[model samples]
Target chain A: MSRHLLALRQATIGDASESIAAVLDQLAREDPVGAQWLRSLDWAELRRLAAERALAQAAKTLACPLQKQYANASQYGTESGDPPKGTCIGVLVGGDTGYGSSVQLGVAIDGQALSFFWNVASQEAASGTLERMRETVRQAFREQTRILMLELLSEDGEVQREQDAAGRTVLRATLVVGGGAR
Target chain B: MTTKGTITIIAIPKSAEVEVHIDLPEVPECTRIAARMQAVLACLGAPLEDIQDLPAPRQRQGVSHAMRKRVRGGT
Candidate 1:
């Protein structure tokens, strides 16, 4: 499985523009018809994921508050979107992930699809799709020797975009083991 | 260290094996994921040529925790 983790090493958290665009794209899909490409994502020759709770479910999600209008996060608030036609795909019992230092992961969702403002107060789970279409080559490199792993846990958490001790728009979640998408 | 490109496979449990480090061009994350998955499938005894041609996965994203039937397709 380390090789699988190695595969995650090359992936970064995605730039703020990509993150914001993804948020918009997902939310727009929830809107009435003809509002698909509110944010343009190249679905061609791309590798993507759709999970039982995307948007913010796998790995931590990022939003540049300085670029809020571009973020299109107003519609969904801070908690973020979920898989349409959903179900409870995961139930994490707040515990510790035992891994050594120096392994990092940055996760995001990008595809020709959408996420929505889910009325999940009563729904126990969410649905999603994960797609891996092809491979690509760009220009980048890092001087490191080791391994990294990425684990996509959940996205649709109940968020309170308040300030931490340092006063940044930090996200904190209290996840339920076998409960609704709260 | 050899000058020629090489591929190595190690025996493991039910999981995939580690591959030789192919110092290729910049690739990973947004791309190469499909290629990595292809490698994994290949480790499982699937043909390489066929794995290379798999279409984008439209498979429904269903959770495997606390559920009965597999959930497919979402709103």
Candidate 2:
């Protein structure tokens, strides 16, 4: 149970971007057809799609924040004739759990296989546990996304997207949790 | 002395000993989040994992007190 409280002032933009992209790719492969379908939807429309699907609960959990305080104090006094005094100091701080979709991707629904992927991802994004989280990761194809989708595919094709059986499209959302407490 | 790490465990009564690691950077906050995560895990009756707090400075008590007050008020 390792933990870190980092006030990272834009120190890990690359990591965040990479993670965001990785998550998108994961969602895309997990449900290819659904990802294709979601790719066809507009970004705003996809955001609205999540909104329509009880987004508040997911939003709350993913937006966890935290704060802490540290203090080191000492006392100084003398018994002999002299003025008496004491010293005290403290540090106060605040930060977030770094969990939320910083960036979003549009997903398109192409077939049933893709549909299951989207449904699962959306469920996980909104209310997913470690088990679901693990399954989602397992289902996503990371390397293929970078080499197959980014290097080869056109800009219009690559997006943070996923789809479901009902032709329902959803965009992949980025969720950031602070690292260091590993 | 150079920065060092710490381990703080907050356990539930009649339950297993839950251990959390508090990296030197965010010891207290790691402690706080670990505590919250522990509660969340317990409520769900789920197995726990070592949750890491992002690297940063220690949290300030004054702000934390204010935030706690706000949380209490909100609830």
Candidate 2 lDDT by residue in tens digits, A1-182 = 22222111111000111222233344455444333433453433322222222122222333422111121111111122111111111111112224232112112122111111111112223343423322222222121221122112222333344444544332322111245211
DockQ of 2: 0.01
| Fraction of the true interface contacts (Cα pairs closer than 8 Å across chains) found in each model | 0.00, 0.00
Root mean square deviation (Cα) for candidate 2:
27.2
Lowest lDDT 10-mer window, candidate 2 chain A? A7-16
Off by over 4 Å in 1: A1-12, A15-46, A49-108, A112-182, B1-75
Q: Candidate 2: deviation at residue A182, Å?
A: 28
Tell me the alpha-carbon RMSD of every candidate.
23.3, 27.2
DockQ of 1: 0.01
Candidate 1, residues B1-75: lDDT per residue as tens digits? 111111112112222222212221222221222233222222211212321212322222231111111111111
